[model samples]
Target: MTVHDVTAPDQERDREALMPEAVIDDEMIASMQARAGVNLRIDHSVNNEEATRIAVTKFAGGIGDINPLWTDADRGRASDYGAPVAPPSFVMACFSGIQFGWPGLGSFHCATQARFHQPVYWGDTIAATCTYEGFTGPKPSSFAGRTVTDHFLNTYTNQRGEVVAEINWQVMNFERASARGRSKRDDKKQDLTLPHPWTPEEIERVEMRVLSEKPRGDNPRYWEDVEVGDGLDLLTKGPIGLTDEVAFIAGGGTPIPRLKAHAASLVDYAAHPAWSFRDPVLGSSEPIYAVHYNQAAANAMGVAFQYDVGFQRQCWQVQLLTHWMGDSGWIIDCDAQYRGFVYLSDVVELGGEVLEKVVLDSGEHAVKVKTHARNQRGADVMPGHATIALPTREGASPVTLRARS
Candidate 1:
């Protein structure tokens, strides 16, 4: 996979002056693929040892989830769980295992699958391990020259050694300059729009929906009562605030040393140029992650504008399920596919429909549901599915998974 650097002539001249030397090459792909299935040492941004009410609240707030089950200590105390429980995806804070494979290549989180074995209580401390599962591609893509999809597995366990959850994540890697050129070739008159301007009426309608969202708290959604085609409550996010991306980083999302000021940031870029690039607009060095929040950086990364973080948006879909399932209900499994870009000010609407209902061999009631998140343009940016175990009228036990070594 020798990625040919194909950039627009003028843009290429400007970017070449400041861009770091990094691209998706065959050697890089081979080295990464060789490590597949091997446990690898990696550093995560935020390692939350214990789940406290404040910890859960910050994470919830980061995703715009106001569900009392995660945000209100008093409400959590009154719930069947007896204490605030972190959202299943909160395990990301412990170890996202997101930084592996094709290091210098521009990347996009394409998919995520998580299976929960137990709830993370306020007092529970978690540890995690990561493995590079593998890679597949250099294949044709709608965007960019070619792409490689890398797979990773992250296992999380409690202090007691009980496996709490396991998440399988996949990222797609591509050459940024190739993508930018491809965009130029594809659409000479691309609509380089800024933040969407919403009419007052439209804003009112979106706000009404957002404000009216309520968790199915206290009400037990018995498995027997749910049928195929039953719809889950809607979850809405955005007209994203200007600093929402910063809020996510502050609330334990991925962090980088490039955030340091002056000489400190220079030291980081000097040491790790592969993960850092000079931002032409800000006249500062920034991590590749700047593409998610800076338009100039995004242009350098082949995207037209700043886009939402895939992991952050995936968490929004996860919240949709958590809100639909009451405290007593457990999320056995959930997965999502990030299919399109969600730019700033894009309003995302998330919902699900019951896909199947089953009674497990252990007599637990489980419901399978298909979920989706569509943006203001009605593009299904993220499509997902979830399996939820609910309390039965006959008092069935909650779903649990065997611990992995």
Candidate 2:
């Protein structure tokens, strides 16, 4: 059948509105689950250096990390590792944007529990697979009687079939009724007592440094020159390291199973699953280093070495824009595809430019931009788009009204 005969215009438009190009099915879900649980081959050769670099950059962006180790080869080489390394969270930046089937997956409220096994290097060709772990929860909701839960476990291995990282993620599919019942509240009440805490002198120093280092290229993007349909160059991020990874996991209250085992032996441990360190969100009493900093357990898990969490990449992307654009711009929406694994000692670079511009009905200048992050090897680990509001070039004045008494 011809394209016109097979898909009607209305149907095509509806499909585009609902989801991405990939179509997820039951069989695909089952297959992904099975493969994730056991060993499944999903390999990608390291041919795309640019893509790798982008992945690392995006991961670094998520973490708000400006460490020279991930950006400068000379500084990285001076480190103990003797070379640049990718951040532990680089895996998330490098891999998540690629299409993996499981319909309604994005609709769920997602959370991740990731364990790093090894350090991925520049030339390593990695393979990965994800499995379904099952589902949980059906808590009462105002709209639908029950909500659905979906769980997935993913593992990535290198060329030698050694597992580098394992991730357990949960997604909560809330019913529409429950969502509609929630109270509408304005959540942005800022504390004004300590606004602009920085001294004028400190602010001047920071502004000078930032202005001097503002990313300038042959293709300069001045505020006045920007217009609709402009494409920005891609951004680069990481060769991540253990220090940053440890900081992130510890800061975010991430739990590690192996560390828990150590803690249980030292103290009187609780028997509850919620109390177990294996539980991603609970069981934090003291600082533990076995999972993130130890090298022995990492090798046992078939990883080249200790690495970082995958979700941190998301954080890096958020950081990139928040820091650069200041609080005035908001992250209206973002979506990423995971492509490859990121290991310690790899450098990443990330940057992006505007794509389109339009004036909203409210006269706000809305700009849509495409952004991406890459690693040292030039692989595009994460690529996505964003929208922002900026001051208009026209310099429109605010409206004023007078009242006659």
Candidate 3:
């Protein structure tokens, strides 16, 4: 369990660097509570179009989003932002991490709720901070037995100090070994509950749609025009496999034995992966990053097989809405709650329908979409929804979120 620490010292001030130092317990709860409201300011620079394009594209690739507004220079420039803007969820990259230590227990993203007040453009500097919202703990769960929930709220601002985004995020911690047995039993039961293996043709058809998608680009989805029952095209990824998982980590920039230097650049802003344990199946050379690649580690953490990262699914939800809302629309809010596991080799189908439509007091037109990610078995594993402000044929998109006071 002696994985190498490749990051140099003096990488940002390790605010949460003290984590995995000990097991999370009553003492840890009190310690974190004492430090509530403490802010960790991390700044990221998007100095040029290429910088923004590369950053956003890497993230979009992780979720398999092929929208031209995020990938093509010509199409992006012609879009409403006048240039390629980061996806509404791109802010997730700037600042995430609870700052509370969870050493032994596997962490699960339970809920992610975010609000965007302004669009992020290239050449802007984003300054973000994370503050502890408090804690709820020692709860029982079939998923994470002996679970505890911690809340971390992140506020994102531009160089001008205008608040552009906020994320109210939560993660649950549990005893891994204890949860493993329950997970296996439930997984088998759930598999029995579902019928039908998706045919190769069915899988190929959806994969094509995901690749062929253009993001509703240039075509503005007028607000006053959307009907409640309008449905989105089915966006799918996989009969998942190693390539998909590895690609996600490549874009996500997680710690890999040989990829240490690449991960070191974000040392100041991102959490360090000090998982010292080696996967037994993969043997001594394996870094803890193998949780997604090593079946043994996956089981130790309560899944029979390697699984998709919850945050990855969160990105999928973001892509789902942007695909439907078009480039001219803005996603002002998004919330996702993970209900179950989506393992490697699972087909994930994503889509949504207009839940409601309304006009704000500011005269901004909007649509609320109920979106979700379902496994091949047709079980919904990630249920989410988003609110988008759309442009109108009568006038341009109005300023819905007023400038920060």
Candidate 4:
């Protein structure tokens, strides 16, 4: 049979425009994994009090945690230890200013599995580094027919060079164009999963507790009263102990085994580096305080037991923005600079206000907000900005398009 070609010009033009810079392969994954580790030094001297306070408060506020041990110094001192204590999650709540070096890795979708080795204390200097643990090739799936997994591990230490916390994180990079045909497979998987719905009565009970336990503040924020330029005050956190850290690590989901192993090591200093004290309070010197996990050591320092990881604070900052904005809103961009160490019994406060509002040419209403996490001493730990979308005022018209349909 004889056939004639009948391709249209516009269709041909569109096909020609669909060129990709590179195809997914093992070479790409290898290159990315090879450069995953980054070394970072912790500076504990600059505004130590403020830094520590801010770090702790940010985490507490972000998680809606109101543990008195972290916020009340006198009450905490009267408890098990003779000083305020940080929450176990405080370590993760504090910010660690480590920048990942990777080319073309636009945005990070991170998942973490953390383990606490020793409690982090106040006035402790920490050093940290991260390594790319591994990577997986594209596996056959309904979505894009494949996907890649990037894994990274971070280890932290006090001034005495004792490893206190270890974290394992994973990220999945999806091929955007290839995701179009996976809906059928996703729907099928969803149908096979069991639904665990909460009862209305149970939900009501939980909500009541949450409302009653909400943190105290001078001004109350009602959903209707919040504006684009309002600021969120600093939230407080810490002094946590090994027990608290273990609780959070056990809860945050991850299959990695190292996290659990590290958590078990916190009880004994022989398994890990010894904690020590440093002189001059704030200097470019080594640390000298030991007993990061011992109750006795914490009492000597006038603080509670060891606390959580500082890096976790970054997650809290992100969480705070998302919680305030609700599910419909998203965090487009965020960055944090770790200023100082957060210890047990530190009070951190996170606050921010609306910076500006702009109407994009595309008719999307965007709100620019600036936020900060600080300690009780008024030191800024992590200062960041977020861009989010909010519903336009009622009856606002959409932007006009100039292109022909």
Candidate 5:
């Protein structure tokens, strides 16, 4: 598990440039503008209760929040929702969704601002869609030689037509030459030190803790009793690997649940080879967006290794508050920031503390938590904050984040 494991694929890719080499120029910017308002993901319906449970289970397991409320059907059914609830962040997994990179160009998911509208329950059908809001840049960005920001609006609605969540996500697409030059020129190198591989005993202990996780489902975490510095239950996850990454991606991006959409994409790519890149070694073709986890694509992006898909880290934070607040709680707002690389063989340990607890003018009770996820070396990779609403013994209503039937 040395840096070589992460960097090997990158070396092979250095021999040739990846496609979609659209440099930041007048023509490219104009094309982007004209494409604004176009739907990036077609509207579609998805329903697969069994897959929802399994998807969230894997999603939660990766982050360490194996709340039975999200993973166990029996426990979930006995509680309030009458079925398991998907993590508030599951929508992100959907939005990282079917990534379509700029033709021959690399794309990076840098940040997301998501507001939860309603909880997605198991058995509920969902219709989802996304539109390109437009481009905003040629502004300064250290990550790209000159970067332009692409903004997208994603919406999820249940079969009842209730909005599940609306997300405004931003990704930066840029010129690779400047990015590569800056990466090579920088004297301070990224710390890719391999950790002592986990022994049998250590691995067993971690697995035991994960199995022992208990969710605070029906019991209300009243705002009146919560303190300013209360701690949340720790859900330790990962020494995650390629299987975990592939399992997540295979879950699907199409409006239909599970692998249907992603499978359809594969079939479409095979029928229309123009949409995919053929890998001689893997002896197959893949979508242009495969760089999110493909080592070759990571290398092409000038990264030292294949890294954590951004949603894996982002959704973990959502699992944090949801586990602490119980099924009755609602996530009002979350702002997730991805700072550095989380390469393969990296374990992200996360924890959060209540920053404040107060009652809004509307008489709704709320608490804010600041959370951090650090790699094995203790370097912070993902830092985020979330506002959560908790029900009250005093009868104060939790703040309403989603208003739908």
Candidate 6:
């Protein structure tokens, strides 16, 4: 399909209607700070209460991840975990974690740092809660001068009450009007109406690479066997389609509700009108989350076009390590940052290289790898690093990963 099929028709919205009139003032900042240390209700649907095979597989499929450790039950059954295990990042599906953004301002998920304590095994029931950790800045930003970085802490636990993962998520809240003024790419001047046109050769090259991805599986990536400059096999995802976004939503990647229709949706808007924006195309109120897939909503938010969700892209970055580390290894921690916007139909290539290797004082072997996700245009959209624990050639025990103290 052509780019036109996925992108919304080009239409302009009046400045007043495009963004909310809210400014980040002392009152707004104080109001947000007041909620610190309070447990906020998770607003999104939990896609998987039990990490069943189907749920695990669905999330794998959502990100185009074919790692057997997550997709093949038999492979997982035969591995060290004793049963099929969900991807470390699959904790995202279990909770509707909070991110504090001002009611009238635009918010962007800037970074995610997660420490994996344990695996979410196939039959485990997972639950979670989030607390507002408050804010850090009215700092210097390219988007808005008045930007504030809001913090949230999310804890995921299984039926056994063991902490599975704790994610420290950061979001930047900025005035939409100010952001629009500072946007680097002006939609009217840039040819963002359609996605990058691809030649068959380009499509084939990406397709071939995607089809070639395979997990290390039983072949343990022993720490002793790895080198600092070791390169990982590249994993490609997208020429992103709307279907890809929908699949992610089906797996519970987002907290924003879509198309609730009539009174139900109206009630939601009435209760949190700041969470709704007037769609220039439909001339109706659309949820703030619609910016991810709705062109009109995206434009209203100062983005050149609709783009992929930051968390979804962040997950793919971690997927790169999981596929490379093999089943025996565990992800100790991951820190991912969403740097650039990945628009519709963009193809993202995930790749990484081993940076350093060390044996923890506990005698657990681990390696640090620098990871990146670049779109077809070669923009580094998501960049991060991870610490992974692997078995040793001398038969040292795999490190028992745990949440930060």
Please report, in order, the local distance difference test score of every candidate based on alpha carbons: 0.75, 0.43, 0.66, 0.44, 0.65, 0.78
C-alpha-based local distance difference test score of model 6: 0.78
lDDT of 5 by residue, 140-233 (tens): 7676667876888778777777787887777777776666666554524653444336788877876686666566766778887889898876
lDDT of 3 by residue, 252-357 (tens): 4323222343345335224544443443333343344456766656655666667776667787888888888787888888899988777776788888888899
TM-score for model 6? 0.90
- Specify the poorest-scoring 10-residue window by lDDT in model 1: 396-405
Best by TM-score: 6
* lDDT tens per residue, model 4, 20-76: 113366667667666545333323211122215445554455455554445666754
| Cα error, candidate 5, residue 155 (Å) | 1.3
lDDT of 1 by residue, 51-152 (tens): 777777777787787777777778766776666677788887666645555665678888999988877877788887788888897787778767888888
Better of 1 and 2 by lDDT: 1
Best by lDDT: 6
Each prediction's TM-score against the native? 0.89, 0.39, 0.80, 0.39, 0.81, 0.90
Which ranges of candidate 3 are over 4 A from the true structure?
Answer: 1-25, 40-51, 187-202, 253-274, 285-289, 398-405
Better of 1 and 5 by TM-score: 1
Off by over 4 Å in 5: 1-17, 43-65, 82-84, 93-101, 184-188, 194-214, 253-267, 270-275, 396-405
Give the backbone clash total of model 1: 0
- How far out, in Å, is residue 313 in model 5? 1.6
How many steric clashes between backbone atoms does each model show? 0, 74, 0, 55, 6, 0
Please report how far candidate 5 places residue 62 from its true position, in Å. Answer: 6.8
Ranking by lDDT: 6, 1, 3, 5, 4, 2
What clash count does candidate 6 reach? 0
Q: Give the lowest summed-lDDT range of ten residues in model 3.
A: 12-21
| Model 5 accuracy (lDDT, Cα) | 0.65
Q: Which regions of candidate 1 are displaced past 4 Å?
A: 1-18, 21-24, 185-192, 256-264, 396-405
